[model samples]
Target chain A: MKLTRRMFIQGAAAVTALMAAPRALLAWPEKAFKAGSSDEVMQALFGSADVTESGSVVLNAPDIAENGRVVPISVSSSLDGVENISVIVVENPSPLAASFDLGPGASAAVSTRIKMGKTSNVIAVVKADGKLYSAQKEVKVTIGGCGG
Target chain B: MASDIRIKAKLTGDTAEVKTLMKHDMETGTRKDKKTGETVPAHYITEVKCELNGKLVMTANWGPAVSKNPYFAFTVKGAKAGDVLKVSWVDNKGGGSSAETTLG
Candidate 1:
């Protein structure tokens, strides 16, 4: 192919225009997330929940996280009946990501996945019978997370 | 792949405080595959166990209907400050989790 002055100018202009395109224009407010381990989040969510460890409340996660960017956690209760269920993480800039309102007939458990910016503790706090309780586990974040 | 799962415990008179955070993917089955033109098989931990010093506190099970990562918080009785508390769980694929903490 032969090069032409007019063609070169046109290509350059197109390249510049493409490079100047704004990302927000491509995907405006897609799926936003709150980053944290879990503990920092529950404390902020509960404030002061007479929180305690209960065998009736169970939380399950991995022992070693292949990636810290995405970790899974589960919280459940078997206290005859459940009033509410909530999930929180500590370490993110904004800790509280979700809060579930459980009614008299609602399930006694709520499970969800969370992104950890780094190695930190995953905390789960439960509210039952007008009282508050909590549980936590240390997620060994090996891979890069939020910043990485 | 976390090891030595542990929880924190505190005691204020008859009230026992326990905190736990497990490590697993509460995977939502709505994601797609980039290369196969199909969806990736739903994979996640589906169950958990919270024990207060060897006594069953709570047990929870979930499915793709849950969130990405999950956390649970609650309180139990019969545990005193300086005593031991144990937590464990079994996943959908038979994976197991265990953690221990001391009250106060």
Candidate 2:
């Protein structure tokens, strides 16, 4: 219990060794595709996003997914002149998710099927001209798929 | 095994539906055998093609970005009833198969 230099050095060595381990070992390789948490996905998308409780960006997905293996997701934006759109799955191994490039004269909507691996909140981040807007929905995965 | 390749499709007035399943290992090139520690070679499907009534309808380019047992669904116009829809896929290993279904 007394202050000992030898003990402190030993503790420091252990801590350093623990930090040396690979990041993948600590967390499963969910990557960006398995995003399941809404809040975390937005945080990943904007670092901090201004999300209002509005139905401007229609995120279509089952409130309760019958299976966790595969879920169909669709994101459509009502804002005119939509320039860019991204989808983030918060709880997935990777958090940045998928991004779409919407050029001028392009439709402001996108729909894609993504693998969840588990229950997650799917979030859509839309970039209009120079502005950023977002919409979110909770998708519950009842059964794990994609080797979940 | 190659014997498991399958493709099922249908074409409706102004719309086409296609479904396909392929036999593949889909190894991501990162996974290693638990006992051997030797890295497994990547063997995944990389592309899929679906034609509606003999016209190109949907083409999907998949990379290591896709998951195993990949399934895709898409619709395209210009397909009339009583036409033929064909689906095919080419894997990373270059194994390919095709199947055709008549419009309903």
Every candidate's DockQ is: 0.07, 0.06
Model 1, residue B66: displacement in angstroms? 10
List the RMSD of every prediction in angstroms: 17.9, 13.4
Which CAPRI tier for candidate 2?
A: incorrect
User: Which stretches of candidate 1 lie above 4 Å from their native place?
Assistant: A1-47, B1-104
lDDT of 1 by residue, A1-148 (tens): 3568889999999888887677334321112123233443444444553577777777787877787655776677777656556655455444553455454423465555566556666666678776776677777778734432
TM-score, one value per model: 0.42, 0.50
Please provide the root mean square deviation of candidate 2 (C-alpha atoms, Å).
13.4
Give model 2's TM-score versus the native structure: 0.50
DockQ of 1: 0.07
- Measured with C-alpha atoms, the lDDT of residue B46 in candidate 2 is 53
| Winner by TM-score | 2
lDDT of each residue in A68-91, candidate 2, tens digit only: 545666666878766556666665
Positional deviation of A3 in candidate 1, in angstroms?
78
Decoy 1 TM-score against native = 0.42
